[model samples]
Target: MRIIIERSNLLRSLGHIQRVVERRNTIPILSNVLLKTEEGAGLRLKATDLDLEITETAPAEIEMAGATTVPAHLLYDIVRKLPDGAEVKLGLNEGGTQMTVSAGRSNFRLQCLPEADFPDITTGTFSHSFTMKAQALARLVERTQFAISTEETRYYLNGIYFHALEVDGASRLRAVATDGHRLARAEADAPAGVEGMPGIIVPRKAVGELQKLLGEAGEDGDVAVELSDSKIRFTLGTVVMTSKLIDGTFPDYQRVIPQNNDKALTLDRSTFSAAVDRVSTISSERGRAVKLAISDSQLVLTVNSPESGTATEELAVGYDSDAIEIGFNAKYLLDITGQLSGEDTVFMLADPGSPTLIKDGGDEGTLYVLMPMRV
Candidate 1:
């Protein structure tokens, strides 16, 4: 393909899609980004890692309408180093084996893979389509992505689950993630056309990339979502991403969420988080338990290690329940606290052996569940 695209535009498009290209690939063509010149759509750039694909369009002057593939990262680096505002000229050799990149005094000759050799993951028909405000979607992802499980054994828990549910007679879209020890759930008003959409598990990788894109979109942007039982697509501005959904059933998360836990302990979020951090330092392992001793109106945080000395901190809390002592992973406690956006948090406790429910006072729709550990 021969096209003249502004350096900034080319770099932006490459940055959006090249991330999907894996550093090591068993297939030769999988390492390349496909560049195709169009008559009215400017220039099209695409990259894929078999499971996920990202495509973006950049404004360009098309000299010849054709297509070719080249190393994704190498081309991105070359374009990134070029002077700002320089026009990048891409030309395919007559033999169709090489392409030349020229901008002012800089030049790069890269081997080309025939576009015909690149495999396209066939996207089947979509069963559901909807749109969500970028900010709203960002909230759901940010609140729960940290809790997504990394254990490969429970493949379903390795991604965020998106489903539609009716709450108080109003449709709502919810995102849930769990790693057995902890769970996070966040919901927002369901967008148009999402009423009967089938639940889908978005793999961890796609969730991360989508999260970045949504973050960039800020508050005014909107993301168009189209999905089927097995595949999903997201369209944001000039970029389009398609991915295969994880084909596993997520557990009924409602079963683990405590229903009758009435013990409420309210404390300043920053204060509690800081205390947890300071006390947990006494333990060498992040998974070590940090004991929480709660009574009438006070909370004591303590950490004990066989090799290291014990550390403890106390803070006044708003609790009127019976005295209770609970142990939780230091890392897990910090994670849930970090996600809380409010000044104060309320933890609903049942017993030392059951899951504790944590709710963000600032965000009523977001909640977390943490399984207690024996100290």
Candidate 2:
């Protein structure tokens, strides 16, 4: 298409859209970013990788109205390296088989693909659409994304599950991710208008993409999230991202959460995390098990390995329950601790073999579940 756009704006949109374009493609058109010039306003840019698509419209001066596709990544790199604030002019050359890009003192030409080759997603019934503050979405993703499973056998667990639930008569949105050994759950107030929306699994790759956009969404702006049965869409001002949902049922995570753990221990989060890191130095290479011995008001973290001797560290806690010994993966414990936003953490224990429930202070909406290891 023939259009003139600011170099900075074009690069910003390209940076986001080109990431969805695959480096190696069986279809030639899939490797290009479709650019269409509007009659009087701006230009539209789109790129996809079969599963996900990103479209952005930016202000541009239109010459002749037309559309063409150029190499997605190559075009992005060229514009990114150019001087800032440069005005870029693009136009269809000779027989419309190629488009020329001119900016500053540099000029380049790229072969064009027919705009008809690009695929379109007819967004089906949007069962839910809502607006949420950017900060809330960021917090929801930060707390639970670390625990997403990477195992291939349990394909369903490879992504974060976004679902709505009622807790204490209040509507809340929860994000849960687990790899079987450790689980993380984060909750936030559910945005209005999505009370009955179906839960969906957001693949890790898509989650990463969304996070990048949300980061740039500005703290004051709200993001509009919409979803149908098969696809999810995120609209932030001038940018829009759409992706296919993972077709899998997430497990009933509520059942896995421990219910009756009465032994409560409160410890300084940083100290405990450091102790776990120190003692785990002697843990075995495979399991990386670290033992926790708690009695009266003292907790001792220890680890033993056949090749390496043993290590132990003591920390003062606020527990009055019967003395208990529990073992857990050092890495898992560290992850749970990393979620703590404050200094003190609360851990509930039933016995040496049961799951431990960890929470920061009295916050019940955010919790961590960790299975004990047999040391």
Candidate 3:
């Protein structure tokens, strides 16, 4: 393949595609990106890690229509370092074993893998398809992705759960994630053509990449999503991403969401977050418990560590119930509060051992449940 593409265009496509390539690959071809000339269309770039694949096309002046594979990260780095506005010329050697990249005075030769060696993720016929504003999808990921579990044993909890639900006669789409310690749930009005979709678990890696691509498309742009029980695909503007879904079943997250916690505490989200942050400074470990003492209208946060000194902070909150003391992970508290896009946050507590329900005043469609820590 021989093509002349603007450095900016080539770099942009490379930046998007190279991230899917793993830093270490057991298969030689898996470390390379497949580059093919599209005649009048443009130059197509593709990279994959077996489970996930991303493809993008950039406008280029095609000299000879052909295909080749080259190291993804190396190509991205080379194009990224090229001077702005420079034109990048890519040419395959006659033997088809090497690719050369040239821009102005810079030149580099990259080892090439046979295009035939590249693997493709077979995307069978999709069972359901839908389209929604890119920003909306991005927001859904932003809301719950932080709660995805990192444990490998619970493979099902490593991704966000997405499904179609009928709520109060209105169809809605929901995204949920939980790490056993905390759960985040966000819902939006379901877009057309998403009915009868099976609940799918989107792996953490795919969720992160999709978030970046959708955000780049901006709020005005629309994203096309297609899925089956085993795989999912996203098409945003010129980019296409296909990923294998986690085959394991997600646990029933709804049962974990608190339904009837009556003790309520309404406090400014910023104030509470700040107090938790300051008190947690004394915690020697990230998961250390921060004790919360609530009485009348005052809330006191205290953290004690044998290695460090005790830290305490007090704030006046709106609470009306028997005074209750609870313990929670300071880091978990900060994460939940940071995600609450509201002036005030409501915490419905049942007791010291049970989970607490958190709601945002600014967003009614989102809720979070956090398991308490033993102080």
Candidate 4:
């Protein structure tokens, strides 16, 4: 294809599409991005890694209408390093085996693959569709993504579980993620057409990609979501992303959430996070465990390690229940606390061994359940 595109616009489109290209590919075409130019439709760019695909379109001055595939990362890097605001001209060579990229004083030729070799990941028929504010979807991802499991054995837990549920007699869209050690749950008001939607486990990579797109779209834009039994699609502006959902069923996360954890402790979110950070400095690298000794109106954070020295810090909190000592992974505590947007954090605890429920005092839609660690 022959097209003239603005350097900045091409760079942005490439940045979004190339993320799906695997660094190392078993199939050569999987590492290349498909570029197609049309008379009135501008330029279309597509990249995929078998399971996920991202397609974006940008307005470009078309000189010739054709299609070709080129190394995604290499093209991205070339466009990125080109002078800003410079116009880029890309054309397929006469042999149809190479693509030439020209921008100002710099010129490069990249080997091309037949566009027909690219795999198609488009969905056939979506059973359910809904629209949500970009900011709300982004918030849901940020709050729960940290708890997604990295382990491969339990493949079902390697992504966030999204479903519709009733909260306080109101319908809400909930996102939940857990890795056995800790869990994060966030809810947003359910939009129209989402009632009775089946729970879907979105893969971790897709969640991250969607987050990036939603962040770029900002708070004002709306994201269109289409879901089927096996795949899900997200459309933001001129970009469309399709991903395969995990095939396994997610565990019953609500069962692990403490129902009657009545012992409540309220403290400054930042102060508590800082104290945990300070104490964790001396914690062992492997466990990274920090002990929380809570009593009436007082909380002491301590860490003891064989290689590193012990650390202890005290902070005044609003705990009126009986004294209890609990050990937790310092990193887990910090991760959950960082998600809090409000000044105060609330912890509802049952005892030292049971899972502790955490929440931002100002937001009832967000919640966290952290399993205790042995000191």
Instruction: List candidate 3 stretches off by more than 4 Å.
Output: none
Q: What is the TM-score of each candidate against the true structure?
A: 0.98, 0.93, 0.98, 0.98
TM-score of 4: 0.98
For every candidate structure, what is the RMSD over all alpha carbons to the true structure, in angstroms?
1.1, 2.1, 0.9, 1.0
In candidate 3, which residue pairs get closer than 3 Å at backbone N, Cα or C atoms, i.e. clash? none
For every model in order, what is the number of clashing pairs?
A: 0, 0, 0, 0
- Identify the superior model by TM-score, candidate 1 or candidate 2: 1
Pick out the ten consecutive residues of candidate 3 with the lowest summed lDDT. Answer: 280-289
Q: Write the per-residue lDDT of candidate 3 for residues 290-344, one digit (tens) a residue.
A: 9999989999999989888799989999998999999999888888898899899
Candidate 2, backbone clash total = 0
Q: Tens-digit lDDT track for model 1 on 230-287? A: 8999999999999999999999999999999989999999999999999998898745
TM-score of 1: 0.98
Looking at model 4, residue 244 earns an lDDT score of 96
lDDT of 1 at 218: 72
lDDT of 1 at 43: 95
Off by over 4 Å in 1: none
**Candidate 4 residue-wise lDDT, 312-340, digit = tens:** 99999999999999999999999999999
Q: Which structure is stronger by lDDT: 2 or 3?
A: 3
Per TM-score, what order, best first? 3, 4, 1, 2
Per-candidate Cα lDDT values, in order, are 0.93, 0.89, 0.92, 0.93
